[model samples]
Target chain A: MSHMEFTGKTVRDAIAKACEELEVDEALLDVEVLEESARGFLGLVGHRNARVRVRKRDVLKEVLEVERPDSRYTNIKPQEFSEIESFSKSGLEDGKITQEGALSENIDKSEIVSQAKEFLEGILCRIPVEAAVEVSVVNGSIELEITGDRSGLLIGKRGQTLDALQYILNKSINRETPLEEKTEIIVDTEDYRRRKQEILRDMALRMSQKAKKSLMPAALNPMPANERRIIHMILSEDKEVYTKSYGEGPLRRIIVYPRKAMPNKRRRR
Target chain B: MKELVEFIAKSLVDYPDEVNVSEKETEIGLILELNVAQSDLGRIIGKHGRTAKAIRTVLNSASTKRKQKVSLEIIE
Candidate 1:
């Protein structure tokens, strides 16, 4: 993530400059107001400009490796498919398949898939982009994939656009469905979710090593809550370091600290 | 308090003139009912009601000074 500081007559002015220079919407950038402007002597002498630091929220550039073909699911044995099918069929007959029927008695997997597809189509129509949505159910999760020439636009920078779409879809679904029965809904384009996860896992490993070596905390750029959770999960089992999220609201960042640097006891007052 | 909700709703929606805010006093507190143009409903509520939550947060802070409880309702 590229961060820059800007000074202006007011905090809003500095944010405006950052947005203009970065060529991104104000809402997309994570902004920190460092200092408020000060006026003295009739707003002419002894005046200080407000300062702010702004950066793109998700700066995965350094961590993102060259795009590679996803092969995680390619190694499944052909003979196991029949066994899994029979297992699922029996599970469904017994009404023990929560993934397909958890949300609501009246709502089914096909209904959720169609509703998701329709929602995505509505967004695409507003964007005036031509694309075909392919829906698939894998292990009870609904996956909506957009495949077309203009699908790149939907992915946005570092898949932020796709994340926003998924967030909205999940929120709408949860609002309509009971909390205990809700299932995961993933929206993606060009296998972005899987690819991003691989990259994030790699980044987490590298950052933890750096934290251990330097004995100093390593703070990552702000990311969506789900991505932050991925980083936390990746390092949860490590004994040498621990991850903590800091900051407020949407600008929260994940920091990895060496275990040795942690304070062992609280100081008495 | 009603004017505050109205002002925020008007600023967020495209149809500012159609935004209407009404207050109802109840036994527990004040209820501010916000009505916006049908098309601009999403803008006021925001994605997953985050905007509405933010608006309520600000209203709570403002109401604290007057020692009154205020709740917001985005009426369809």
Candidate 2:
């Protein structure tokens, strides 16, 4: 079996049970603590057992082989899968710091790129999408481009889906390395991200010009935070206009205001 | 407040039964610790913790009416 669940009085005991049943040492299995044991009043009335899920380091390869005869599984080892999983889970928090640390420590970038490709492939498999990842380094950022038939679906509406995929890949890679090194991961599908950036930059320019011509703040349509950032960054250097975000939650939109209005706003404040 | 967090978390995670939200009163305000099944952790946290941040935004708005400070922590 690739993985099994075990329960005991405590997490440690649960892990021990898994190791014993699997006939392997602790190092051979990746442990995921599911629940912490609870002790009731008087230490005798009620108590809850701890739960854990353990998976063998090598079983993943075997399982993947049996489940899918695809050639993609040939290159990925089981140990790498488990390692990536554990680190990605823990690496969810403070991802920025972890990424920076991983980069500075001289962690191999090629290894990270391959692992990220594998991780993306795993997600694409779930969606039943057929795609191949091409890795290249551009301007110091590792870009993994997904190319295949169903790439449009992966890009999703306004590239929101691509953003989600990239976020997961970055987190997984950052988790795989030591915290002292930093790595920059950029995920693109058929150059969709690049094209979208160009579109946004053009829109930002157009809106800023309108704002300056009308001598009034121009509010753009609501967009995701990242897209909004692109607009803000593009206009930030312009002498005629500046951008500010207004509204709440996901519906927040950016308002490009003329630079000449800045002094009046400060005076009112 | 705890129930709100629990409800939002449960809706996001795959294993609703394994999702737990506990509240502790702190000197600064209320601290809500969220725990979820290992497999469902990413879903609850979302891409770059955006889902978690959105949940906190909703929590802040809800708690503001009570005039009480509140914060959330996703405990791994």
Interface RMSD per candidate: 13.1, 11.6
lDDT of 2 at B12: 60
Residue B7 C-alpha lDDT in model 2:
62
Best by lDDT: 1
* Model 2 error, position A31 (Å): 67
Clashes of each: 0, 13
Alpha-carbon shift of residue A18 in model 1 (angstroms): 38
lDDT of 1 at A23: 90
Candidate 1 chain B: 10-residue stretch with minimal lDDT: B57-66
**Tens digit of per-residue lDDT, candidate 2, span B1-76:** 7876676566566688998988899999999999999998887687667777656655654455457898999999
lDDT of 1 by residue, A72-132 (tens): 2123333233233333333444233343353353345787788778866765543445778
Error of 1 at A242 (Å): 1.5
